[model samples]
Target: MTVQHEPDNWRKSSRSQNGSACVEVGSFGDGAAIRDTKDRAAGYFTADRDQWSAFVAAIKGGRFDA
Candidate 1:
């Protein structure tokens, strides 16, 4: 199901560099919303709770590290 969310209370990634693209996330009902730091007005992605948890776990496990 697609859920609409308004961005607020965003926390930025600590790994973000000063002059690089970044993202911020905010909590919503039973899920979370993500937005680009460079163009927040452009758009965002909302993930359900389970999906969000798994995504976080993958990050912790270095699944996307290069």
Candidate 2:
């Protein structure tokens, strides 16, 4: 699937400091857009609303804990 990059407003996480390493996120219709703050022109990852929600929940639940 081709992911279209939108001009929607992108915001970095508040935890981002010095604008060095960070991720930017924005809403694209019923989905979400995520891109590296350091390389906005490269590419981004998009996920449906439900998928995004589940991913966020997993993160909060430490499903990726190692």
Candidate 3:
């Protein structure tokens, strides 16, 4: 399915430095959109809100970090 990205509310990761190599995320109702900040027009990836939350939690818990 095609994802609709709202650039206006997209937030960059705090760990992003100098706006380089940064990803941006925006919430759209029950889902979230994620895309490369440097190429927003290229399109985005979308996930259910709950899945997004779980993904974030996993990242914070280092479940996906090597």
- The C-alpha TM-scores of every prediction are 0.80, 0.80, 0.76
lDDT of each: 0.85, 0.84, 0.82
Model 3: residues >4 Å from true position, as ranges? 1-7
Q: Which ten residues in a row are the worst by lDDT in model 2?
A: 2-11
Error of 1 at 1 (Å): 14
Q: State the lDDT of candidate 1 residue by residue for 1-66, as single tens digits.
A: 976548568888787788648888998788898888889888788898999999999999999999
Q: Which 10-residue window of candidate 3 scores lowest in summed lDDT?
A: 1-10
- Cand. 1 Cα-lDDT: 0.85
Cα deviation at 44, candidate 3, in Å, is 0.8
lDDT (C-alpha) at residue 25 in model 3: 85
Kindly give the number of clashing pairs for every candidate.
0, 0, 0
Better of 2 and 3 by TM-score: 2
lDDT of 2 by residue, 16-62 (tens): 79765898889876889899978878978888999999999999999
Which residue segments of model 1 deviate by more than 4 Å?
1-5
- Looking at model 3, residue 53 earns an lDDT score of 92
**lDDT tens per residue, model 3, 1-66:** 876546468888787798558888888768788898688779888888899999999999999888
